[model samples]
Target: MHDDGHGPGPARRQDQGAARHEHGHSHHRAHSPSHEGARAAGRLRHRLAHLLTPHSHESADRLDPALEASARGLRALWVSLAVLGATAAVQAVVVVLSGSVALLGDTVHNTADALTAVPLGIAFLLGRRAANRRFTYGYGRAEDLAGLAIVLTIGASAAFAGWTAFERLLSPRPVEHVPAVAVAALVGFAGNEWVARYRIRVGRSIGSAALVADGLHARTDGFTSLAVLAGAGGSALGWQAADPVVGLAITAAIALMLRDAAREVLRRVMDAVDPALVDRAERALSAVEGVHGVGELRLRWIGHRLRAEVAVVVDGEATVRQAHAIAVDAEHALLHAVPRLTAALVHADPAPVAGQADPHLALAHHARV
Candidate 1:
């Protein structure tokens, strides 16, 4: 027996439970206030922890959290793009005035980082499309492709920055308008830092690996912007080679960002999710009434939402109707316990009986094939 968790399955059971609880409500009325208070306190703690260190998939209670998340992701992308664009524009003017290679490298990277939002925005839009016959899983994977594009863009920017820095190192030149370079670098740092925090918060809340990777990229740019300030200080002290050296350092930072972003995107493409989520699913399934055992359980991301497939063991003597009821209960438990979970498929299996042939034995040869 199987349950898809979208239909109204076993509503009679829920109503009966409510009725029973209401009949016995007077017996537990004295403790209800404390229990409610404890639950509220727990929720507050979890909320605070989530804000302090955001994870990939946080719990949401919206009817269509996926759609809400997508809208938030798009808004974050456009706002971040505008912020970084302005930062880069200001640094570009400073680069022209001071001719600081370090500032130039930072500007280039900031511009590229800002433009990354374009492909990501497109991917978010694509993700909203309904699934078709050919693409049964929908266009969610487009975000992964956008993440690949971001990684490549980061790589290209790093290469260009490295090359420019090398050329400047070979032919040393004075960096003029040192004070202006310092001011521009500070501006870049502030802007990138704000955008990084914004993107990361929204990305984590929405469970978008690509958006988080982009946020990390912006964070690296912020630090590199600070490095530009060091070069400005050196140029003021008559160290003509300092600007190129700092530019090279910025390139190395971008390379590191590229490595990290590539790894995250690759993991998403591989359908990797946090192991703790699997553990939680197992616990939830085991807790469901009438579930004798939890068999194999699997979870994978379809865009920011999660889908689950799990097998649960029930009494072999139970009727088909009873087994199916257990499956529906298991599915409901799973959907409630797993954060970001939009759907679940629960399969009920009969437990083994002594002297009985294995029910799946007939299909063993097919499994091998």
Candidate 2:
């Protein structure tokens, strides 16, 4: 072979030098305008990701809305118990002095109402316990049980109020110091109304129907207390029958409250969640980028928290990965759409064509907190 001017070593070194030069050129090309534009897009996507997702640091105390609601509910219970205790104490003193059956009945109910908070507070605390193997949904149903207990208590109160008032009406007795009874009645009204408004406001804000019902009970009790004041006024005007008559009226009022509380308790027990929440979930699923339809959306309350099961329809041409992404989007949207929703399970299916059976039709859809 003829000797070339460049030996084997020189040729190998030259090849290496050319490869290094080409690599440098390619690296430099990576920073060109188009490449920088792609980098900018990558950076924008990363930033958008941060904005779209929740931050761990935002929950510094790790207190979510449901947890905060439970905490606030406990606080409200304690405060109302204190207020009603004070009110009932004053009324009990008046009851002893004046021997007014109406005031005594009111005092009893106010005390019972205050005590009802105990079961509810216990329920709220129980609801905080994590789910177990036997109770996959946790102890939230305890709230419904607490609600039932409250209904029973109120019913018993009404029966007692009615019986006592009827007995008093049968045997007339003069109520002494009518003015003291009236003052106690007024105190009862003020305290109960305050508690009612506080509980209702807080309960509604926290999406706690049980608490709202309890608040309504307090409101009804306030009106009954007002009836007691009317009785005192009637007794002062020499209409002795007015005291028993007012007590009977309070019993009737309490009957009405019992009906309301019973209905609320029954609804919760039957898993009759608000229809508006269902509508909101459907709307959110429909709005997702690849979701073409929403079907079989179910929502329910376990304790105070909400849970949803939603079926979403995506394009038939979508790959499994694409369908998964759509389902995830639907899940996220549903969570934000419904208040107090703690969990959501989204099922994605292909959009059905004409004469084609829907894929999600036969699937089991169930929701529980």
Candidate 3:
């Protein structure tokens, strides 16, 4: 829906006095870079104010929200790639002018961050593909594989930064152009921090853990970028070891990012989701009028979005039409309850007696231990 950031949406506008379930997400047409830039600025500003608010529902929900979000995410990746690429290019020039290994390490890390946008962008683009026989769930899982690649990139960056740092430690060298190095370091910090904030903001909105982790990576790179300044400062102080020591510190910081990135990527691979999100889904299922109780509820990440399988108990005497209606309502409710829930499979089963056997329960399920 078009959100000009003025007031309530059409659904909320119907009854502005009361809180309502948001049935739709918001987006505005970006006619130009200034338009998108202003939106981003406004997003950060109004984030806290609209933290608990959901998108208002529209009369006709034509496009898939999940696909739209993926498209937006791809655009964000493209912009970040451009910003970081330019930042890295500027630093690379500085690295040639002033041979500071710490600056070099930071530059390498930023370059890798820019390169990472390629895989993730590919993943987002591929995620928009319709499901096929060979890949029934589409290529969403490619995002996870891309996340793995990101983790590998982080590790490789750490190794290179660490090695260069140690090599410099062993053979200390003079750092040239003290003022220029500091200026480049500041440029690096500004670029990375901006990209970090942008990525993290978009990632959270899109519910992409990998994107969020990558944002954190950019932030770490920002801080490491500052370390170059410390090295320049040391060199000015006639402390030759300061540059290498700072380089070592930058490596250590990257190692920390590697750990966090690995944790998030592995969790995606293992198909773990927040327990609270599952509980919200269960509550949504229970809210259905004909649903007697919520049974099995399973959720998994297909890239940034969630897919769910829910089993609901209904009155044994209900007609198939009634049951189908209940399932549809329950699915809609669950989708509204949990943000980023793209699809849900709801099974309507006859209500069982107390302590009675249900064959479905006896079968192996993803939920049971």
Best by lDDT: 1
Model 3 alpha-carbon drift over 4 Å, by segment: 1-63, 354-369
> Over the stretch 1-369, how does candidate 2's per-residue lDDT look in tens digits?
001111234446434433321211111212346644664675577469869984531222223666788999999889999999999999999999999999988998999999999999999999887666787767889999999989999999999989999999999898999989989999999999999999999888887778888999999999999999999999999998999999999999999989998998899999998787787788878876667788778888888877777777766655454455556567667656788777666766666679966544555464233
The better-scoring model by lDDT among 1 and 3 is 1
Q: How does each model score on TM-score?
A: 0.83, 0.82, 0.80
Model 3, span 1-369: residue lDDT tens: 121122346555434311121111132222356644664565475456556775543322412677777987888889999999999999999999989899999999999999999999999988877666787777889889988999999999989989998999999989999899999999999999999999999999988887888899999999998999999999999998999999999999999888988998899899999899988888878766667888878999988878788778866555454455567667767767988776666777776667856645545575656
Instruction: Give me the overall lDDT of model 3.
Output: 0.80
TM-score of 1: 0.83
Q: Candidate 3 clashing pairs?
A: none
- Lowest lDDT 10-mer window, candidate 2? 21-30
Q: Write model 1 residue lDDT over 146-262, tens digit each, in one string.
A: 999999999999999999999999999999999999999999999999999999999999899999999999999999999999999999999999999999999999988889999
Predicted structure with the largest TM-score when compared to the true one: 1
